[model samples]
Target: MPENPVDPPGLDLARLRAHLDRELPGTVQGPLDAELIEGGRSNLTYVLTDGTGRWVLRRPPLGHVLATAHDMGREHRVMTALGGTGVPVPGTLLLDPGTETLGAPWYLMDFVPGTAHRDAAPLAGLGAPRVHAIGERLVDTLAALHRIDPAAVGLADFGRPDGYLERQLRRWSTQLAASRSRELPGVDRLHGLLAARLPESPVPALVHGDYRLDNVLVDEHDAVAAVLDWEMSTLGDPLTDVGLLVMYTELAGVGGGIIPSAATAPGFPSAGELVARYAGLTGREAADLDWYVAFASFKLAVVAEGIHYRFRQGSTLGAGFERAGEIAPVLAEHGLTTLKER
Candidate 1:
């Protein structure tokens, strides 16, 4: 659990305790306490405890919502479907779809202990070798995730895998239109170029929409303890995942305080090396990577812009949000250039 977490804005402890008691009697003996999990902009996460037992809960942000951006059910369903698979997810305990409990839907799962590499500072003491191992383990885990068969896992109908990239572009474009607060240059141009150069996607796999190094928790032995944040998980093109990973690794140096990036850690594999490793392990052609990478940058630009919108409305709770507004243009320019180079 993160340190110094009060109820904050969205969580009400009294309602949470009463609901827990009603749902599962005697499971919670003492009074419940909760703290807001920091370092996230989309959903509101809380670490709940009853003296000894601890669980993590996820809910949507306080106000100004989008259509499919914060679907708690989608997150819970994907994580639940991935229970027995190689994908390391916490044991899901409960899910509430109604808003009567805590003003919105939320679910609970076991809290695994480890460090999530949001920035390079966490790996400063681990030396170069361990950091390299950590990087390898991250790619390995992504490959493992893509290998899972949705049919075998009872998730074949989770999403329409056909024309997934086109749908994705439309979806993100819709999201961007709804959240636009200021002038954004080149986003539409990048979108046009990406749509024009759409690649031939391979068999659909379990795509973690935001698969980056910081999204996974790493243990002391440099192993990925678990992959967190399933809010954006779906069945889609596997190269989309690879491209996003590459974009994050390559742009970690230039996020310029827009997004938190830990790819600068010593001995961490370069973006090209990581892409080759993924291709070698998965035995898949990585052609048309530039289009996908540009798409990733475009997607992240919209995400940062959304955060900036929330920040402007005073709905976001974090320090780094101030720079979010500036991130969209930088990423948009990068996306436009990436696609043009191809």
Candidate 2:
């Protein structure tokens, strides 16, 4: 593990213990062992454990943030609402919306026990036949998410449906404008093209804001245990979710020589297979997916730019921060290519 310690603020052990005693009662016994579990520039997630009991504490990064963003209570509510819907999410146990409890709004959920593969290196050499099954299951899980009725899940009030694409275009444009780092030339053009080529969405579905391999947890049996990270999730066009899933297909391309064994197996389907399966399951045509693909690319570019800006301010470490600046151009290129094809 890296030696650099993350300065996770507002996580007072004594306060958390008091809250647990008042809220959870008997769920967690013994002393809690909380450690920083991979934090990005945005939120802080800690893996808390006590004997056989484990839970995850998620809260906004220490400091200011957009009003609508990083609301732990909202995240917790969404997770709790989606329980038993076959979406494969961590079980939400307690939610503390007021900052009085943890210095910031936060929630505790059952720490899903599984391997979160961020890269393809470890997955490739595992030599497990269940990898293929897990891959298929991953696709199926996404299909299930896209098929979920946001209204039924109480997320109809989550996000605005009308002008959703327009709002996204403007949001990214604003982020691009506010960016302090070097701006990519293709980004503005991509945004313009996206605005002009917006397509009609059939219906809004529950879209996992970041639907990628790293956000998914796979158990020892190669089963997807949970879909982690719900910060960006909302009711939106299902195609957006599909496009994001496709955009990160290269995750399995990591480690150069070692690819997920499922990619080569006869029975296992590729990323394209997953998209086709989504179409098959939802009975929706895949022709309009290009626009969503472009949208996904553009959206990610905006997010990457935010990290790049923070890195320049000396708030974050690692060469990956500098590398993040490159994502905008690549994503812009992808968006342009998708638009041209359309």
Candidate 3:
């Protein structure tokens, strides 16, 4: 067992080292050091090093975890299944389902080196052509992901795709209800409008539920290195992912400094361009994406509300949580306007 001078919150370094030694011997050659990675609102991510090798570990949040929200096994299984596919994902190394070691199920994967640009300033310095190319590649990668057959990747049973959009609406509504603390104007109306106008979903594909520029890591050559954060991945209406991407890009700076976005940087593709590029690559009709975008806005509003709830309850970890509440109403208003315009 490695000496533990200090263990970061939500991690037990000595037990983790012992488990690693037992599961995969000699993986750790020296003292293990870990630091919790910030900016994660759901799963707790950490970067670990043993003076030789570096890896990443993910686990559920420390306290007040929802029953089905943070499934470590699901994340591991999806990434492992997509290993051979064109989608770039971190190579999963091990999954510990039992809670004996870390008090919760956790998994580790190779830490791919790249930059996850969350803000627009750095990307603005990258010049317009490079940023534009990166944006195009981002869309192209998403198209490739949507083109994959779930069964071919051993993920046919990953999630039930039938009526995915409808179920998604219900799920988020329940989530919002669970986290509701104060009245949010327009949220209920947005939800009602979405329920009244659910579009016919196209053929389902494996969807990265939260697809955005920052969720992916880009390499020096401006290619996507690996897509990160698969807690939300499932077999669903692929356009839901597209709509989320478009929403993030469109609402880049509207989060009151709570939501970080690189999409607003100079040379990044416009929301319209991104939608068109995705349509061109996947040959899917994007004409009826207005509803999808509106739903995306509503979904994000729910998520922001959830975060605000946690913050108010004093259960949220890290900085900038207090500002999350401000974004919910803004997103709800945007969602309402989107539906009204259609």
Best by lDDT: 3
Candidate numbers sorted by TM-score from highest down = 3, 1, 2
- Residues 1-342 of candidate 1 have per-residue lDDT tens digits of 334335667888778878888887776777677878888878888888888788899999877788888888888888888887888888787888999978888888889888888777777568888888888889999999999999988889888899999999999999999999888999999989888878888999989999987788888778888898888888999898898998888788575645656788788899888988998889987889998899999999999889989988988876688888887898999888877776
After aligning candidate 2 to the native by TM-score, how far in Å is the CA of 8 from where it should be? 4.8
**TM-score for candidate 2, residues paired by index:** 0.86
The lDDT per prediction is 0.85, 0.72, 0.89
Clashing residue pairs in candidate 2 are none
Q: Candidate 2 on 1-342: residue-level lDDT in tens?
A: 223333344478767888899887887677766776753545678887675777899887654354455778777888888899989899998888888867788898988889866554466666545656666777788888878887887877987777777887787687666764675868888888888888887787777888766678888878889998888877777778787777666333422312222244333456677788878888877667778888888887777777677666765433345566766677778778877876
| Model 3 quality (TM-score) | 0.97
- Model 2 accuracy (lDDT, Cα): 0.72
lDDT of 3 by residue, 235-271 (tens): 9899999988988888896775566668889999999
Please state every model's RMSD to the true fold in angstroms.
2.0, 4.0, 1.7
Q: Write out the backbone clash pairs for model 3.
A: none
Ranking by lDDT: 3, 1, 2
Model 1: number of clashes?
Answer: 0
